[model samples]
Target: LIATILLYMGVALFCGCGHEALSGTVSILLNYFDVTKGPGGGLDVFTIIDILKYIIYGLAAGFFVFGVLLLVEGFFTTGAIRDLYGEFKITACGRCLTAFLMFLAYLFFLVWLGVTAFTSLPVFMYYNVWSMCQNSSSMEGANLCLDLRLFGAVTVSEDRKVCTGTEKFSRMCVSDELDLTFHLFVCALAGAGAAVIAMVRRITLSSDCS
Candidate 1:
């Protein structure tokens, strides 16, 4: 039960931090690039951002409910609960429910794994930009550029380059927003990993109990 609580804490952390980091990332992209008016694309940046925001919101609510259900299930399976309530017999329905939950937990683990990897892509991209800023003194003559097109932020064929030599790029690199967003994403990643482990443990425990 204690382990389950700790794991849920990680899920809570991921939901909160991931949402904030995603907002920050969108803000940075919109502020620096022309993502709002990408030519020839059916979907605008605003639409995509809105979709992602909604998805995160749904995930937060879903996880909270699921976590509560899992906690209750864990409590019922514990020796303490059994002692207090007397030996509870597992019926066919109970067994089926446990099996279903185990499957769901495994599914969530896989989903979070994908999410963690997706979250890392932005962190990786931002890290490269930060690295370029750090080595700006040495690479004086190089045209250090970050293209939004590569990341699918813009569909336009025109170059949306944020170079090291530009004032906007320098300001962005030095800004606390960038640092905060990066750290938040990192925290979110860690949280997702913890949640994955928790889900795996939950599945194992459920299988044993069943």
Candidate 2:
């Protein structure tokens, strides 16, 4: 009873009062790693919420797979599954789900990391080039830079200012794909979160059974 009462209080604290505004008490007390606007309000940085989403997704997928298995087992003869293998249990199922989620999270993290890294190619090779003279750098033997923007949509002048016409030393390329990369990164984080949740569920199930 005490445990139950404490749990309820914890939930109430976590969720805040029904009448209270979400942005009010919750923001003040529970705003742990929430990301707001980025530099100059341009973008939002990664936050704990993004990771939580991934974990939730993984947990959801685990539940879905468990449901499917239940349906399949139901169709099978009562002891058929046990006869072939061993007695199936929800705790084991949860662990399996956690493992699957972890695998998916690893995959997503790899892909997100790869894409984000590749997208940095332009920045490394050359960020700006002369748009008018068609060369950003006067350095001899420098590799001609790859233009990220449309062929003629923009250019950089010798003064290093952006302009419309073919200005020397204009930006050779600009990255717009990073936003997508960021989104993917966020998804990968969700996968990570799912893995965590699945593991937690596995532990909880084990404890409950014990």
Candidate 3:
């Protein structure tokens, strides 16, 4: 039960950090680059981000309620509650519910795997830009560029697709916003992984109890 609570806490952390990181990423992209305005245009980027925001909000609320219900069910199935209340049999319906929860946990585990991967994509993209900036001194006269079109964040266009060794890139590299967003995404990735593990453990425990 304690472990389950801890797991839910990890999910909460992911939800909070992921949402903030997404907002930070959007801000940096808009301020430093012409993502939304170009011959190619990027209304799709905004649409995707807006959709993800809604999904995250739903996941946060759904997980909170699901966690509470699962914990309550765990209390009934585990020996702790039985010992306190004297040996009581769980009904067939209770066992079925536990089985259903185990299945649901497995599904959630898969979902978290996808979420972790999605979260890592932005981190990976930012790390490339950050690394190029860090090694700028060595690559003298070479054009260090970040292409949003390559990542599908913006449509393909010659003029606005790439950010070269410009003032914007330099400022973006030095900005606290970029650093904070990078770390936040890293935390969110870790949280997603933790949630995956937690769901696996939950399934195992539910299987045993059922």
TM-score of 2: 0.25
Runs in model 2 deviating more than 4 A are 1-90, 126-210
Superior by lDDT: candidate 1 or candidate 2: 1
| Candidate 2 C-alpha lDDT tens digits along 120-139 | 43223222321323333444
lDDT, residue 207, candidate 1? 75
Q: For residue 174, what is the lDDT in candidate 2?
A: 31
lDDT of each: 0.80, 0.35, 0.80
List the lowest-lDDT window of 10 residues for candidate 3: 155-164
Q: Show the lowest summed lDDT stretch of 10 residues, model 2.
A: 17-26
Task: Report the lDDT tens digits of candidate 3 across residue range 1-210.
Answer: 765876787788899899999899789878887566434644577778878889989998999888987888888877777788685777789878888888888888889889888888888977887778688768878885677777777666634444546788778878899889988988988888888888888888887876
The estimated TM-scores of all candidates read 0.90, 0.25, 0.91
Native-to-model Cα distance after best TM-score fit, residue 108 in candidate 3, in Å: 0.8
By TM-score, the best candidate is 3
In candidate 1, stretches whose alpha carbon ends up further than 4 angstroms from where it belongs are: 37-42, 83-88
Report the Cα lDDT for residue 45, model 1.
65
